[model samples]
Each structure stands twice: as structure tokens, then as C-alpha cells.
Target: MNDIDDFAQAYVLHRRPFRETSALVALWVENLGLVRAVIKGVAGQSKSAILRNAWLQPFQLIRVQIRGTRDLKTIYKFEPVPTGVVIKGEPLFACTYINELLLFTLNKHEPELHFFSYYQEFLKRITDIFRPDTEIEPALRQKQMIIELRCFEQYLLEAIGYSFDWGSARDENIEVNMAYGFEPGEGFFPQASGLYQGALLIAIAQGQWQTKGALGAARAALRQQLEWVLGRSLHAPSSQGKLMRPENG
Candidate 1:
């Protein structure tokens, strides 16, 4: 059966050069999942080429028409969708990180409509917390980024059939002054010298985006789980996942 979408909302996850005038585009379609398509005639300063370059920008929401019988489809049409979700700085890098995550985890042609909405929500929240200038403190901004990332990772893992639970320590509720360790199959358990403390865990469970210690702890736990889930890591996760510009970026 040939999967098709005549008109759909999509976002550009990643784009790289292909041939001369065309490029390979990876789109997260609204009703469909990940779709890799050939976008033709996007080179030079032609009027049409200028439009496609502006519209197909990374993380920009857009409308598209993709059609093909096999795994690789060709983009027949696409246009940008305007929105207030303007992302920059750490949040922008976070967007790339999640884009990489979807590329690694999502299978082509599978319908994950809800996940698409989840992603839109993620961007909105990032936009909400992100300050364009130095209005927010560095520590606070990093903590917020960490919180958003943990939540995003948790949902992604659940969607892929893995659970990285931080709700509690096994059956007992998380206490503010205690330590806890994590097990892959089971959940959290009490450990006097565990990596994360209950104060941090409680803040995490409560969605405390600005709590000290919680940011690093939450990041450490989810990153470990994410690495295990992927069986590896992405391009410089530690640096790419932060506000500081990565060397390559």
C-alpha cells in the first residue's frame, strides 16, 4: 500500500545537500510520521529557490504535500506557517537536539500524530521560558532547558516503549532529604549514596524548572536512559544540549 498525504502540516527536522539543485529533506508530517523526500530546484537565487529556502528552514512549521510509493517520497509542495514560536540560543540548540532525537527514533511512514502535537507544545513552552536578551540569569536558563529536555526525553521514551520513571522511589514517595538509585527494569530505590537526592527528585517530580541540583540530576538520569535506549549517544550531547555554543555549531 502506498501511504500518501495530499496536504499536511510538517516541520523541517534536518536538511542536507543532495545533487546540485535539489536537497534531501526530512519532515515530521502532521498525520504521518517521519518522511524523507527529495526537494528539487532549490539552488541558486531564482525566485522559487528563495522561497523554498526561507520556508524549509529548520524547525519552522509548514504545510506540505508529499507523495510516493516507497520509503523515500518527493516533496511536491510546501509553504511556511507563521507563528509566535521564535526560538533562539539554548532553546534553538534544544530544538536541534530533539530534531536529532526524532530522526534517530521515529520510523518512516508510521503515524504519530499526537507526538507531533507534543512536539509543538514543547516548542511553545521553550519559547515561553526563553528570554531574547539577558533578562534571565544563566543558571536559571540552563535549569529551564534541562527541565524541558527531561520531560521531552521521558515522553519520547514512553512513545518508543521504554519508561524512565521519576515519580517515586519504587513504592515509597520521594522524600526531600533522602538519596535514591535507579535500576533499568525496576524504578527508583533508596540508596544512602545514590546519585540523585530526594530534594532534587521531588523538585523534578513537581516540575520545578528552576531548582538547584534538580537540573543536573534530572539531566543525568534521563541522559543515561536515553543513551541506553539508543544504544549510543548523539553528536556531542553534553555540549549541544547546553546554552553554550558547541564548537561545530
Candidate 2:
């Protein structure tokens, strides 16, 4: 246990006041999926930059070193990922939303490295948009962002042991042409009759661009199921299960 302590990385996910001068923080480290640590005297200490308003933005990877304590551990050291890029605008906020979800849903000291890595990669993809020379058009960029977000949502649902099947129904080996609603236990079913739609599944399987409308419809179906699975811990409750709106202009 002592040796393993030296290998942990530091991450600052969320923080709140623990007392008048101290703060409790949620950190996601490489070795530890989520850790609750207290920043002693953060509100009152002049040298508490690491606690008050440090560089621990979500999605920006950092290397952390911590020493375990009887109560709250000490954050020994930390630094930004050398190759990290700053994400701007609504995307950045969306990233924060994801971090909040992880912090809220995950158990402390639990090692969910796969989910952490998925988050790291997602951040990298968004950071690409901030690159100086990328020439992706604004409309195309929005489309790409939506597609990526949808994919991430699916990934999150699956990773958390939720059942979500996008399979479509078909007759005579031909695609089933209809929209379906997603249910937590029942999967995807036709709009009114609770029947499965095979054609939508086929379209998703084929990765056809024409299926954007279908995919959008399917996403709406899944939202209902996901909401139940996510429960009351959903972030940005005012958004109410809707995808964060893309920036205009």
C-alpha cells in the first residue's frame, strides 16, 4: 500500500467547502478512479493556489502525486499534461458536465481506468477543433461534434452495464422503415405498438449518412431510457435530458 501510494496521479475534478477554511475535492487519478481529498486551510491559506483556483480544469490531463493521510490525503504535486490543449466555448462546458457526471456517479477509490481513458480521448478530439490550422467548416464541425457526442453517450450507457440495443427490424431481409422508442428493459420498439424496428438498426450498422434523421430519431428514443438509468444525478438539470446546444456564429 505504501509503494502504490507513490504511483498515484493527481486530478482535481470538483471541490466544495468542507469548513470555513478547508475544502473537499473530488480527484480522478490514473491509479484511483475517483478520490475524495481535503484541501486543508484552502480558504484561509495564501499558498493554497492548488485548491482555490488551480489549473485543474476537466479533460485537461494532469500528473498527480499524493500522500495518504488518516483523514484526507495530501496532494503532493501536480502538473498539466504537457501536450494538453485548451478547449473553448460550449464544448468546454459540456466537458465539464461529463466530469461532473463521473464525479457524481463513480465510487471513491474505485478504479474505472477505461472510462477515464475514454474521457481523455474525447477531450483530445474536442481539442483538435481548437487547433490553429484545422479547416473543418463550421456546419461540418457541428455535425461532427453531434456525432461524437452521440457515440459517447452510447459508450457511456454500455460501459455502465445498461442494456441499449439499436437493432432494427426487417421483413424479407429488407430494412424495416419506422421509428422506435427506447425503453430501459425492453430496448428499442416501434413508436406506438412497442414493436422493434429493424430498418433503423440496419441503417446504423451500415453507417449510412442518409440515416442521420433516423439516428437522430433513435437518439431521442434512447434519451428516455438513459434518463432513467442516469437517475436524479443528471447534470444541468435545466437542460432536462436534451443535448447541449451547439454554439451559434
Candidate 3:
């Protein structure tokens, strides 16, 4: 948006130190889909700098006043907003997984407003997973995370115009008992021996998360389709451990 002054809520999708006094930030906002911004004096001991530093972090809801007409903008004001989102350990990698996907897949400077709610829902589920009172087993927690990330991956694909047609396979009515394989532009076609079973695919498509084979099939299909869209291996942000295993595809 080419406004002399613009104010909106934003989350830092990705960022790095830029030069001596500024940070190069990639932001996702409701009004401006994706933006790369420069915010200065973040490291200073001054109160404003500290506020900017705290507010301009991933998963925190920060209100900013920015001004620019181009792809890269400048943030001139930071409105304080208290945040309780703390993502760390294994969960941090999952958080970064979706954040990186957003940075890479979304078009810069366009408003995908619905993504704001989509992202917030994701962060809510993530926060619940790490909440101390939840008392979930490690194995079950991992399964919950797999379902959330795969669903988010599907949202990203839909936003980018690669959404799947759940009801049909290769232009024919999808048979729930059959197996199918995904092709880049050709959609899904039935396979006598396929990596994806129609029932599992339907469960995921309908937002129902199940155990064992269903999760496995969902993960495999998403991995293959997402990697195909990116045209490379979808590497999780560097970790000593592996996250979800979508190896069936």
C-alpha cells in the first residue's frame, strides 16, 4: 500500500540483523499479505528500541505504523502489545516450518486477509500443545502436531492456487476404497498400488485427524505435493532431530 503512513497488526515471519542499527524483517499482516521491512535502532538501550525489539518477533501480535510505496517498507512506529507466545524446543521447529513456508510461498505486498485467522488458529493449537497443564503423552503430542502442520500446508497450497480436488480423482468421482497418486498439473489419478488411499485422503480433506495409517497417508501426500510445488526438498529448519516423517510418499 502506497500510503504515506500505514498502521496494521503484524507478525515477523523471518528476520535478520541488517547493517549496524537496523533489522531486515519479513512481516505477515492482515492488510498487507507479506512485506519486507526495515526497522531501525532495535538494539539500542532506549525504551523505544526495546519495545520495537520485543514487539517485532515471531508469533507476537504487534501493531506497527509503516510508510512506503515499494516492496520494502520502513516501520516508523511500534505500538506496544503484550505477548505470551513462547515457542521452543521441538515445537519451535514446527513453528518455523510454517513461518518459512509463508515467507517462500506467499506473494509480497498482497493482502491475503483470511490467512491472519488461519495463522492465529495455528498458533493457538501450538500454544496448547506446549501448555503445561495439558498433560499429553509425547507420542500423542507429536501426532497432534503432524495434523496441524499438514492442514496448514494445505492452506498454503490453496492460497497459492494448487489446492486439491477432494471429491474427484483424475476427473472422475473419487472412490473411497481406491488408492491414488498426485501429479503436479494433472491432479490425482487412481493407482492400483498408490501411496495415498482415498479414505485417508478424504479424512484429511474433511478436517478429521485419525491415527496410524490415515496420518501417514496424509503426511505422505502433503510432502510429495508441497515439495513438488517448491521444486526442492522441504527441509525443516535445522534441528538435531527429525520432525514429521512423511516417508510413505
lDDT of 2 by residue, 1-249 (tens): 222335455556677777676667778877556666765555654666545445555555667666674446666555666556567874666665556555545642243457767777787887786566668766577566666666666677666676455654221232476645556655654564544455656665566535646556545655565567656434244222433322220
The worst-scoring run of ten residues by lDDT in candidate 2 lies at: 240-249
lDDT by residue (tens digit), candidate 1, 215-242: 6776677766766666555544432243
Between candidates 2 and 3, the one scoring higher on lDDT is 3
Candidate 1: Cα lDDT at 172: 80
lDDT (0-100) at residue 49 of candidate 3? Answer: 74
What's the lDDT for residue 98 in model 1? 76
Q: Give the candidate order by descending lDDT.
A: 1, 3, 2
Candidates, ranked, TM-score:
3, 1, 2
Q: Give the clashing pairs for model 1.
A: none
TM-score of 1: 0.82
Please give the distance, in angstroms, between residue 238's alpha carbon in candidate 2 and its true position after superposition. Answer: 8.8
